[model samples]
Target: MSHYAVFGHPVSHSLSPRIHAEFGRQTGIALDYTAIEATPAGFAQALDAFAAAGGKGANVTLPLKEAAFALCSVTSERARRAGAVNTLTRNDGQWHGDNTDGIGLVRDLTARLGLDLRGRRTLLLGAGGSARGVAPALLDAGVSELVIANRTPERADALVDLLGEPGRAHSRYWNDLVNEGDFALIVNATSASRDGLQEFSLPFALAASRTLAVDLNYGEAAIPFLAWAQAAGCRDRVDGLGMLVEQAAAAFELWHGVRPDTAGVYATLRGKDASLVTAD
Candidate 1:
């Protein structure tokens, strides 16, 4: 069996192995996908160890996405554009990086969730790796406006500058939520929910009746924000489970030169109702 792994700091909670195992079973690819805990300081060493162990490909997550990008010998245009890498292919002793996060998020929102993103006013919370990986795609998906807010305003501003769409994308302080007006879509992309570091402290006014709140997190990490959206009266809140499945399929395709049926795997993960537990 070919070796594969996912690297991140708090990766013990990952369901990548389960998702990928299902993909391999569907596609007849013999592969082992595991998650490893790696901090920023030790990521390179950990990656070196994996590569030494005959690893063929891997997935990068969380704070490690940019770190993975930095370690890549080559990266796809989307990876370059996003300045992050979520998928990695081993090529003759080199790591080739690509980002499928953007496409994954877009596919989930438009294709699966039945959301027409054209001209939707959106608010993206956080400007971290997850935010970077999906921001460009959201803009390209025709969100009329994207206001990025982060605890660190400079990071948010830098991401906007990278996007190079001042007319459509702007950066704001998280403290300015009330004045920023309601959005048709709000995405929680921060690691806060995963870290369990602090209360979300989001405003109820940030939601409109038409608003769809999305948290780029699933399982325990997803509850806080999705619950907030529910309590804030937004009916169509979504967790990241679908995006996770979609993105995993993209990564598996890149690694194996074949695409597996994601619907079955996603359905399996999602259970009989095919609805997130967050749904009413």
Candidate 2:
């Protein structure tokens, strides 16, 4: 059987195994997908073992994406731009890194949610890896302008500098967000959502006009931000579940050369309600 898994420190909580299993069943592919918990110090050893055992691909998450990028012999342009890799494919005795987070987000928004991002103004909260991973894709998808904001102003400025184009992308302090008016889309990529921090305040006007408020952290991490978005009267509030499944699908495609149907798998995984799955 072809083997695959997701690598993360706290990976036991991931629903990837269930999601991919459903995709495999639906697509008539035989595979084993599971979650592997690897601490920062142990990731290299774990990866080596998996590769030696003939693992075809792996999905990486959290604090290890950058490490995965460094470990790969080759990396996709998107991964290079983001400085991180969430997907890895083993081929010809070498590992290749790719960043599918942005593509996943775009697919969920444009394909699933039917949101039109073209020529739309967007506000991206947080300037960390999550924000950086998705910013370039959003711009490429035709977002008229993107304003990246963070609690620490310098981080946001640094991302802007890294992106290197003032015409479309800009950086601003979190406090300045209130005066920037409404945006068509608002994406919360901050760890604040995951940490259950409620100290961050957003502009009421912006919140009200945002067609979608997307929290990159799903399940428990999404609660605080979703609550805020609901209270702020946003039209649609979504978590990262869709993005997770889509990115995994992208990784599977890179390895198997087949794009598995994700809609059914996404709905099935969402219905399980366990957040994590185990082999029976």
Candidate 3:
């Protein structure tokens, strides 16, 4: 079987192995996919060992995305723009990196969540790797205005400047959310909850009755932000599960030369019934 894995510090919770197994079943491709725990300091060494062990490709998550990017021999434009790499493929004794996070999030938002990003006023919380990965895609999706907010004002400004869309993208201090006014879509891209940090106490007025709230963290980590959105009367809320599944499909395609259908796998994962998964 071809070998693959996902590398992250706290990756036991990842559904990637199961997701890719289903994809392999659908395509009749024998593959072994697993999770490998690796900290930033050990990432390069772990990756090199994986490549030596017949590993074809892998996914990088959390604090390791930027580290993965630095190790890549070459990268896609999106990866370069994000300054992070979430997907890696071994080729010609070197690694080729790509950032599938943005496209995955966009597909989940537009196709699964029925969101029309065109001309929408969107608020992106956080200016870290997660934010960087998706900001360009959000702009490409045609958000009329993208407001990035973070505790570190300089980081937020730096991300906006990197995006290179001065007229449409801007940054704000986290405490200034109230004066920034309400937004149609508010996405929590921070790792606060995932890192066990205190839940963000955002201004309620920043959301309106028609606002949609999103948290880029899944499972228990998503609850704090989703709960806040609920109390604020957000019309809809979403966790990162959809994006996770979509991004896995993208990576599967990149690795195996085909994109398995994601709907059934997503439903199965969401409903916790593996028997219901269908790759077709």
lDDT by residue (48-75, candidate 2, tens digit) is: 9999988999998776877888899999
**Between prediction 2 and prediction 3, which has the larger lDDT?**
3
- Global lDDT scores for all candidate models: 0.87, 0.82, 0.87
lDDT of 3 by residue, 126-223 (tens): 98777888888998999899999999999999998888889999999888888988899899888888667656688899998899898888777788
In candidate 3, which residue ranges exceed 4 Å CA deviation? 273-280
Error of 2 at 9 (Å): 2.0
Per-residue C-alpha lDDT of model 1 across residues 1-280, encoded as one tens digit per residue: 9999989877776778888999999888888888889999999999999999999999988779999999999999998878889999999899999999989989988888788988899999989889999999999899999999999999999999988889999999888888987999999998786565545679899996789999898766678888888888888988888899889889999988898888877778878433332110
User: What's the lDDT of the predicted structure labeled candidate 3?
Assistant: 0.87
